[model samples]
Target: MLAVLASVFVISMSGALMPGPMFATVLAKSYKSPWAGAQVSLGHAVVEVPLILLIYFGAATILENDITHLILGIVGGGMIIWMGLGMLRARKAYAGGTKDTPYNAFTAGIILSAGNPFFIIWWATVGALLVLKIADYGLGGLTALVLTHWAVDLIWLSIVSGLVYKTHRLWAPALHEAVFVACGLLLMGFGGWFVVSGVLAIG
Candidate 1:
Protein backbone atom coordinates (compact mmCIF):
# COMPACT_ATOMS: atom_id res chain seq x y z
CA MET A 1 0.00 0.00 0.00
CA LEU A 2 2.79 2.38 0.92
CA ALA A 3 4.53 1.53 -2.27
CA VAL A 4 1.38 2.17 -4.25
CA LEU A 5 0.87 5.56 -2.62
CA ALA A 6 4.51 6.43 -3.05
CA SER A 7 4.47 5.53 -6.72
CA VAL A 8 1.39 7.66 -7.19
CA PHE A 9 3.14 10.60 -5.58
CA VAL A 10 6.16 10.24 -7.76
CA ILE A 11 4.16 9.91 -10.93
CA SER A 12 1.89 12.81 -10.01
CA MET A 13 4.86 15.06 -9.32
CA SER A 14 6.44 14.13 -12.61
CA GLY A 15 3.39 15.48 -14.39
CA ALA A 16 2.93 18.51 -12.13
CA LEU A 17 6.51 19.60 -12.60
CA MET A 18 6.31 19.51 -16.36
CA PRO A 19 6.02 22.85 -18.14
CA GLY A 20 2.57 23.18 -19.62
CA PRO A 21 -0.37 25.54 -20.03
CA MET A 22 -1.28 25.24 -16.36
CA PHE A 23 2.23 25.99 -15.24
CA ALA A 24 2.34 28.97 -17.59
CA THR A 25 -0.93 30.25 -16.18
CA VAL A 26 0.42 30.06 -12.69
CA LEU A 27 3.56 31.90 -13.74
CA ALA A 28 1.58 34.61 -15.52
CA LYS A 29 -0.57 35.26 -12.45
CA SER A 30 2.04 34.98 -9.72
CA TYR A 31 3.14 38.51 -10.39
CA LYS A 32 0.26 39.97 -8.40
CA SER A 33 -0.35 37.36 -5.70
CA PRO A 34 1.90 34.96 -3.94
CA TRP A 35 -1.11 32.83 -3.07
CA ALA A 36 -2.04 32.37 -6.72
CA GLY A 37 -0.89 28.77 -6.61
CA ALA A 38 -3.25 27.87 -3.78
CA GLN A 39 -6.13 29.58 -5.53
CA VAL A 40 -5.20 27.81 -8.73
CA SER A 41 -4.96 24.51 -6.88
CA LEU A 42 -8.53 24.98 -5.66
CA GLY A 43 -9.62 25.66 -9.22
CA HIS A 44 -7.75 22.57 -10.37
CA ALA A 45 -9.60 20.58 -7.72
CA VAL A 46 -12.93 21.81 -9.02
CA VAL A 47 -12.18 20.12 -12.35
CA GLU A 48 -10.44 17.16 -10.78
CA VAL A 49 -13.34 16.17 -8.55
CA PRO A 50 -15.46 15.45 -11.60
CA LEU A 51 -12.52 13.76 -13.28
CA ILE A 52 -11.98 11.41 -10.38
CA LEU A 53 -15.60 10.36 -10.57
CA LEU A 54 -15.25 9.88 -14.30
CA ILE A 55 -12.28 7.61 -13.82
CA TYR A 56 -14.33 5.56 -11.39
CA PHE A 57 -17.01 5.30 -14.05
CA GLY A 58 -14.50 4.28 -16.73
CA ALA A 59 -14.56 7.46 -18.79
CA ALA A 60 -11.11 6.90 -20.24
CA THR A 61 -12.60 5.24 -23.28
CA ILE A 62 -14.38 8.46 -24.20
CA LEU A 63 -11.35 10.62 -23.57
CA GLU A 64 -9.21 8.37 -25.73
CA ASN A 65 -11.30 8.92 -28.82
CA ASP A 66 -9.42 10.50 -31.73
CA ILE A 67 -12.26 12.86 -32.52
CA THR A 68 -12.37 13.90 -28.91
CA HIS A 69 -8.67 14.74 -29.01
CA LEU A 70 -9.00 16.65 -32.25
CA ILE A 71 -11.90 18.72 -31.00
CA LEU A 72 -10.24 19.51 -27.70
CA GLY A 73 -6.99 20.28 -29.45
CA ILE A 74 -8.62 22.94 -31.60
CA VAL A 75 -10.79 24.48 -28.91
CA GLY A 76 -8.25 24.32 -26.15
CA GLY A 77 -5.51 25.53 -28.42
CA GLY A 78 -7.46 28.66 -29.25
CA MET A 79 -8.04 29.41 -25.58
CA ILE A 80 -4.38 28.94 -24.72
CA ILE A 81 -3.34 31.24 -27.54
CA TRP A 82 -5.81 33.82 -26.34
CA MET A 83 -4.42 33.46 -22.85
CA GLY A 84 -0.89 33.90 -24.13
CA LEU A 85 -1.85 37.06 -25.94
CA GLY A 86 -3.43 38.36 -22.76
CA MET A 87 -0.23 37.70 -20.92
CA LEU A 88 1.82 39.44 -23.54
CA ARG A 89 -0.43 42.48 -23.48
CA ALA A 90 -0.42 42.58 -19.71
CA ARG A 91 3.29 42.00 -19.47
CA LYS A 92 3.86 45.44 -18.10
CA ALA A 93 0.45 46.16 -16.64
CA TYR A 94 1.11 44.46 -13.33
CA ALA A 95 4.13 46.53 -12.55
CA GLY A 96 2.08 48.69 -10.22
CA GLY A 97 0.86 45.57 -8.41
CA THR A 98 -2.63 46.93 -7.74
CA LYS A 99 -4.89 45.69 -10.53
CA ASP A 100 -6.24 42.17 -10.95
CA THR A 101 -5.39 39.99 -13.91
CA PRO A 102 -8.04 39.48 -16.56
CA TYR A 103 -8.47 35.96 -15.26
CA ASN A 104 -7.93 35.32 -11.61
CA ALA A 105 -5.74 32.46 -10.51
CA PHE A 106 -8.68 30.20 -9.74
CA THR A 107 -10.35 30.78 -13.07
CA ALA A 108 -7.09 30.32 -14.90
CA GLY A 109 -6.62 27.04 -13.07
CA ILE A 110 -10.04 25.81 -14.07
CA ILE A 111 -9.75 27.03 -17.64
CA LEU A 112 -6.28 25.69 -18.19
CA SER A 113 -7.08 22.33 -16.70
CA ALA A 114 -10.19 22.05 -18.79
CA GLY A 115 -8.66 23.46 -21.97
CA ASN A 116 -5.39 21.56 -22.03
CA PRO A 117 -6.04 18.39 -24.02
CA PHE A 118 -2.91 16.79 -22.68
CA PHE A 119 -4.23 17.24 -19.17
CA ILE A 120 -7.42 15.41 -20.01
CA ILE A 121 -5.53 12.75 -21.92
CA TRP A 122 -3.18 12.23 -18.99
CA TRP A 123 -6.14 11.74 -16.69
CA ALA A 124 -7.57 9.25 -19.15
CA THR A 125 -4.43 7.19 -19.36
CA VAL A 126 -2.01 7.72 -16.46
CA GLY A 127 -4.63 8.95 -14.04
CA ALA A 128 -6.88 6.00 -14.75
CA LEU A 129 -4.06 3.62 -14.02
CA LEU A 130 -3.22 5.27 -10.71
CA VAL A 131 -6.82 5.32 -9.60
CA LEU A 132 -7.39 1.70 -10.53
CA LYS A 133 -4.23 0.53 -8.79
CA ILE A 134 -5.24 2.13 -5.54
CA ALA A 135 -8.97 1.60 -5.87
CA ASP A 136 -8.42 -2.11 -5.37
CA TYR A 137 -7.74 -1.42 -1.70
CA GLY A 138 -11.22 0.05 -1.40
CA LEU A 139 -12.38 3.43 -0.07
CA GLY A 140 -9.34 4.34 2.01
CA GLY A 141 -7.04 3.63 -0.86
CA LEU A 142 -9.17 5.68 -3.17
CA THR A 143 -9.17 8.56 -0.73
CA ALA A 144 -5.42 8.41 -0.37
CA LEU A 145 -5.04 8.36 -4.12
CA VAL A 146 -6.95 11.59 -4.60
CA LEU A 147 -5.26 13.38 -1.73
CA THR A 148 -1.81 12.22 -2.69
CA HIS A 149 -2.20 13.23 -6.32
CA TRP A 150 -3.62 16.64 -5.45
CA ALA A 151 -1.05 17.13 -2.71
CA VAL A 152 1.72 16.98 -5.26
CA ASP A 153 0.05 19.65 -7.35
CA LEU A 154 -0.56 21.81 -4.30
CA ILE A 155 2.95 21.65 -2.96
CA TRP A 156 4.73 22.23 -6.25
CA LEU A 157 2.47 25.07 -7.36
CA SER A 158 2.67 26.79 -4.00
CA ILE A 159 6.43 26.68 -3.98
CA VAL A 160 6.64 28.01 -7.52
CA SER A 161 4.15 30.82 -6.99
CA GLY A 162 5.68 31.65 -3.64
CA LEU A 163 9.09 32.03 -5.12
CA VAL A 164 7.79 34.17 -7.95
CA TYR A 165 5.82 36.27 -5.47
CA LYS A 166 8.87 36.78 -3.33
CA THR A 167 11.05 37.63 -6.26
CA HIS A 168 8.55 40.15 -7.61
CA ARG A 169 8.20 41.59 -4.14
CA LEU A 170 11.42 43.38 -4.89
CA TRP A 171 9.66 44.97 -7.85
CA ALA A 172 12.21 44.15 -10.44
CA PRO A 173 10.49 45.66 -13.42
CA ALA A 174 12.98 44.31 -15.95
CA LEU A 175 12.73 40.80 -14.65
CA HIS A 176 8.96 41.01 -14.56
CA GLU A 177 8.65 42.03 -18.19
CA ALA A 178 11.19 39.49 -19.35
CA VAL A 179 9.67 36.58 -17.49
CA PHE A 180 6.14 37.40 -18.57
CA VAL A 181 7.22 37.67 -22.18
CA ALA A 182 8.99 34.38 -21.99
CA CYS A 183 6.04 32.72 -20.34
CA GLY A 184 3.66 34.23 -22.86
CA LEU A 185 5.74 33.02 -25.74
CA LEU A 186 6.03 29.60 -24.23
CA LEU A 187 2.25 29.28 -23.90
CA MET A 188 1.73 30.47 -27.45
CA GLY A 189 4.22 27.92 -28.65
CA PHE A 190 2.45 25.11 -26.86
CA GLY A 191 -0.90 26.29 -28.15
CA GLY A 192 0.37 26.33 -31.70
CA TRP A 193 1.80 22.88 -31.33
CA PHE A 194 -1.50 21.49 -30.13
CA VAL A 195 -3.37 23.05 -33.00
CA VAL A 196 -0.88 21.91 -35.59
CA SER A 197 -0.83 18.39 -34.31
CA GLY A 198 -4.59 18.26 -34.29
CA VAL A 199 -4.76 19.62 -37.83
CA LEU A 200 -2.21 17.13 -39.05
CA ALA A 201 -3.98 14.30 -37.33
CA ILE A 202 -7.25 15.30 -38.87
CA GLY A 203 -5.75 15.58 -42.36
Candidate 2:
Protein backbone atom coordinates (compact mmCIF):
# COMPACT_ATOMS: atom_id res chain seq x y z
CA MET A 1 0.00 0.00 0.00
CA LEU A 2 2.83 2.37 0.79
CA ALA A 3 4.49 1.53 -2.46
CA VAL A 4 1.22 2.08 -4.30
CA LEU A 5 0.69 5.44 -2.67
CA ALA A 6 4.24 6.58 -3.34
CA SER A 7 4.11 5.41 -6.94
CA VAL A 8 0.79 7.17 -7.44
CA PHE A 9 2.13 10.42 -6.03
CA VAL A 10 5.20 10.34 -8.25
CA ILE A 11 3.16 9.57 -11.34
CA SER A 12 0.53 12.18 -10.63
CA MET A 13 3.13 14.81 -9.82
CA SER A 14 5.00 14.16 -13.03
CA GLY A 15 1.85 14.52 -15.08
CA ALA A 16 0.77 17.64 -13.18
CA LEU A 17 4.05 19.29 -14.05
CA MET A 18 3.36 18.96 -17.74
CA PRO A 19 2.24 22.05 -19.64
CA GLY A 20 -1.29 21.05 -20.38
CA PRO A 21 -4.46 23.09 -20.77
CA MET A 22 -4.84 23.11 -17.00
CA PHE A 23 -1.33 24.40 -16.52
CA ALA A 24 -1.92 27.20 -19.01
CA THR A 25 -5.11 28.15 -17.24
CA VAL A 26 -3.26 28.17 -13.94
CA LEU A 27 -0.79 30.68 -15.33
CA ALA A 28 -3.49 32.98 -16.69
CA LYS A 29 -5.95 32.69 -13.84
CA SER A 30 -3.32 33.11 -11.15
CA TYR A 31 -3.40 36.79 -11.90
CA LYS A 32 -7.07 36.91 -10.99
CA SER A 33 -6.83 34.77 -7.86
CA PRO A 34 -3.77 33.78 -5.92
CA TRP A 35 -5.56 30.61 -4.86
CA ALA A 36 -6.49 29.78 -8.42
CA GLY A 37 -4.51 26.57 -8.24
CA ALA A 38 -6.55 25.12 -5.38
CA GLN A 39 -9.78 26.30 -6.95
CA VAL A 40 -8.86 24.74 -10.25
CA SER A 41 -7.80 21.53 -8.56
CA LEU A 42 -11.14 21.37 -6.80
CA GLY A 43 -12.91 21.87 -10.09
CA HIS A 44 -10.82 19.14 -11.62
CA ALA A 45 -11.85 16.88 -8.78
CA VAL A 46 -15.47 17.45 -9.70
CA VAL A 47 -14.78 15.67 -12.95
CA GLU A 48 -12.18 13.24 -11.72
CA VAL A 49 -14.10 11.84 -8.77
CA PRO A 50 -17.05 10.83 -10.88
CA LEU A 51 -14.77 9.44 -13.54
CA ILE A 52 -12.94 7.27 -11.07
CA LEU A 53 -16.22 6.03 -9.71
CA LEU A 54 -17.51 5.18 -13.15
CA ILE A 55 -14.35 3.35 -14.01
CA TYR A 56 -14.54 1.50 -10.73
CA PHE A 57 -18.02 0.28 -11.56
CA GLY A 58 -16.82 -1.28 -14.81
CA ALA A 59 -17.42 1.52 -17.33
CA ALA A 60 -13.90 1.30 -18.66
CA THR A 61 -15.03 -0.45 -21.82
CA ILE A 62 -17.22 2.43 -22.84
CA LEU A 63 -14.55 4.93 -21.98
CA GLU A 64 -11.88 3.03 -23.92
CA ASN A 65 -13.83 2.51 -27.13
CA ASP A 66 -12.24 3.96 -30.25
CA ILE A 67 -15.42 5.75 -31.17
CA THR A 68 -15.53 7.30 -27.70
CA HIS A 69 -12.00 8.50 -28.09
CA LEU A 70 -12.79 9.98 -31.49
CA ILE A 71 -15.74 11.89 -30.17
CA LEU A 72 -13.86 13.01 -27.08
CA GLY A 73 -10.94 14.19 -29.19
CA ILE A 74 -13.18 16.20 -31.48
CA VAL A 75 -15.57 17.69 -28.97
CA GLY A 76 -13.12 18.17 -26.14
CA GLY A 77 -10.49 19.54 -28.48
CA GLY A 78 -12.95 22.08 -29.87
CA MET A 79 -13.80 23.28 -26.34
CA ILE A 80 -10.13 23.72 -25.56
CA ILE A 81 -9.61 25.68 -28.75
CA TRP A 82 -12.55 27.87 -27.85
CA MET A 83 -11.08 28.53 -24.39
CA GLY A 84 -7.72 29.50 -25.92
CA LEU A 85 -9.45 31.94 -28.22
CA GLY A 86 -11.44 33.32 -25.31
CA MET A 87 -8.27 33.91 -23.32
CA LEU A 88 -6.71 35.76 -26.26
CA ARG A 89 -9.78 37.92 -26.65
CA ALA A 90 -9.87 38.77 -22.97
CA ARG A 91 -6.15 39.46 -22.62
CA LYS A 92 -6.66 43.16 -23.04
CA ALA A 93 -9.12 43.31 -20.17
CA TYR A 94 -6.40 42.53 -17.65
CA ALA A 95 -4.55 45.75 -18.39
CA GLY A 96 -7.11 47.61 -16.32
CA GLY A 97 -6.55 45.14 -13.49
CA THR A 98 -9.18 42.72 -12.23
CA LYS A 99 -10.60 41.15 -9.11
CA ASP A 100 -11.10 37.54 -8.22
CA THR A 101 -14.11 36.36 -10.17
CA PRO A 102 -14.71 33.72 -7.49
CA TYR A 103 -15.86 30.89 -9.73
CA ASN A 104 -13.80 31.96 -12.71
CA ALA A 105 -10.85 29.68 -12.14
CA PHE A 106 -13.06 26.98 -10.74
CA THR A 107 -15.14 26.61 -13.86
CA ALA A 108 -12.07 26.88 -16.00
CA GLY A 109 -10.75 23.86 -14.18
CA ILE A 110 -13.88 21.79 -14.75
CA ILE A 111 -14.35 22.79 -18.36
CA LEU A 112 -10.73 22.73 -19.44
CA SER A 113 -10.23 19.40 -17.71
CA ALA A 114 -13.34 17.83 -19.18
CA GLY A 115 -12.23 19.02 -22.61
CA ASN A 116 -8.72 17.64 -22.39
CA PRO A 117 -8.24 14.49 -24.44
CA PHE A 118 -5.06 13.61 -22.66
CA PHE A 119 -6.76 13.75 -19.28
CA ILE A 120 -9.52 11.49 -20.47
CA ILE A 121 -7.11 9.11 -22.12
CA TRP A 122 -4.98 8.87 -19.03
CA TRP A 123 -7.95 7.97 -16.87
CA ALA A 124 -9.19 5.52 -19.43
CA THR A 125 -5.92 3.60 -19.52
CA VAL A 126 -3.27 4.16 -16.86
CA GLY A 127 -5.72 5.54 -14.33
CA ALA A 128 -8.17 2.74 -14.97
CA LEU A 129 -5.45 0.19 -14.36
CA LEU A 130 -4.56 1.87 -11.13
CA VAL A 131 -8.19 1.84 -10.09
CA LEU A 132 -8.49 -1.88 -10.66
CA LYS A 133 -5.31 -2.61 -8.84
CA ILE A 134 -6.47 -0.61 -5.86
CA ALA A 135 -9.81 -2.39 -5.84
CA ASP A 136 -8.17 -5.52 -4.51
CA TYR A 137 -7.27 -3.68 -1.36
CA GLY A 138 -10.87 -2.55 -0.98
CA LEU A 139 -12.27 0.93 -0.42
CA GLY A 140 -9.27 2.14 1.52
CA GLY A 141 -6.92 1.76 -1.42
CA LEU A 142 -9.40 3.40 -3.73
CA THR A 143 -9.79 6.30 -1.34
CA ALA A 144 -6.06 6.64 -1.12
CA LEU A 145 -5.77 6.79 -4.88
CA VAL A 146 -8.35 9.57 -5.20
CA LEU A 147 -7.01 11.63 -2.34
CA THR A 148 -3.43 10.96 -3.34
CA HIS A 149 -3.99 12.06 -6.91
CA TRP A 150 -5.85 15.16 -5.85
CA ALA A 151 -3.24 16.03 -3.23
CA VAL A 152 -0.41 15.84 -5.70
CA ASP A 153 -2.30 18.00 -8.16
CA LEU A 154 -3.19 20.50 -5.48
CA ILE A 155 0.36 20.81 -4.20
CA TRP A 156 1.96 21.25 -7.60
CA LEU A 157 -0.71 23.59 -8.96
CA SER A 158 -0.78 25.69 -5.79
CA ILE A 159 2.95 26.21 -5.87
CA VAL A 160 2.96 27.17 -9.52
CA SER A 161 0.05 29.56 -9.20
CA GLY A 162 1.43 31.04 -6.02
CA LEU A 163 4.70 31.83 -7.74
CA VAL A 164 2.89 33.36 -10.68
CA TYR A 165 0.68 35.41 -8.40
CA LYS A 166 3.57 36.70 -6.31
CA THR A 167 5.40 37.94 -9.39
CA HIS A 168 2.30 39.40 -11.05
CA ARG A 169 2.74 42.83 -9.49
CA LEU A 170 5.96 43.35 -11.42
CA TRP A 171 4.40 42.67 -14.79
CA ALA A 172 4.06 45.54 -17.23
CA PRO A 173 1.00 45.83 -19.43
CA ALA A 174 2.89 44.40 -22.37
CA LEU A 175 4.20 41.57 -20.28
CA HIS A 176 0.72 40.73 -19.06
CA GLU A 177 -0.61 40.53 -22.56
CA ALA A 178 2.41 38.56 -23.67
CA VAL A 179 1.93 35.99 -20.93
CA PHE A 180 -1.74 35.64 -21.73
CA VAL A 181 -0.98 35.26 -25.39
CA ALA A 182 1.61 32.62 -24.67
CA CYS A 183 -0.75 30.69 -22.41
CA GLY A 184 -3.59 30.95 -24.90
CA LEU A 185 -1.40 29.76 -27.72
CA LEU A 186 -0.19 26.88 -25.60
CA LEU A 187 -3.77 25.75 -25.09
CA MET A 188 -4.53 26.04 -28.79
CA GLY A 189 -1.45 24.06 -29.65
CA PHE A 190 -2.57 21.20 -27.45
CA GLY A 191 -6.08 21.43 -28.84
CA GLY A 192 -4.80 21.34 -32.40
CA TRP A 193 -2.81 18.21 -31.81
CA PHE A 194 -5.78 16.46 -30.23
CA VAL A 195 -8.07 17.55 -33.04
CA VAL A 196 -5.73 16.46 -35.80
CA SER A 197 -5.06 13.13 -34.17
CA GLY A 198 -8.73 12.52 -33.69
CA VAL A 199 -9.45 13.33 -37.29
CA LEU A 200 -6.75 11.05 -38.56
CA ALA A 201 -7.98 8.25 -36.36
CA ILE A 202 -11.41 8.70 -37.82
CA GLY A 203 -10.01 8.36 -41.31
Give all candidates' CA lDDT scores.
0.82, 0.83
lDDT of 2 by residue, 110-141 (tens): 98777776687789899998898788888888
* All candidates: TM-score: 0.92, 0.92
Q: What is candidate 2's CA lDDT for residue 28?
A: 88
Model 2 ranges off by over 4 Å = 98-103
lDDT of 1 by residue, 1-203 (tens): 88999999999888898888778778878877789888899999999978887887778788777787788778878887888887788777755555556778899788777776778788898889888888788878888888998999999999999998888767567887787788888888888877776666567
Error of 1 at 183 (Å): 1.4
Q: Deviation in angstroms for 38 in model 2?
A: 0.8
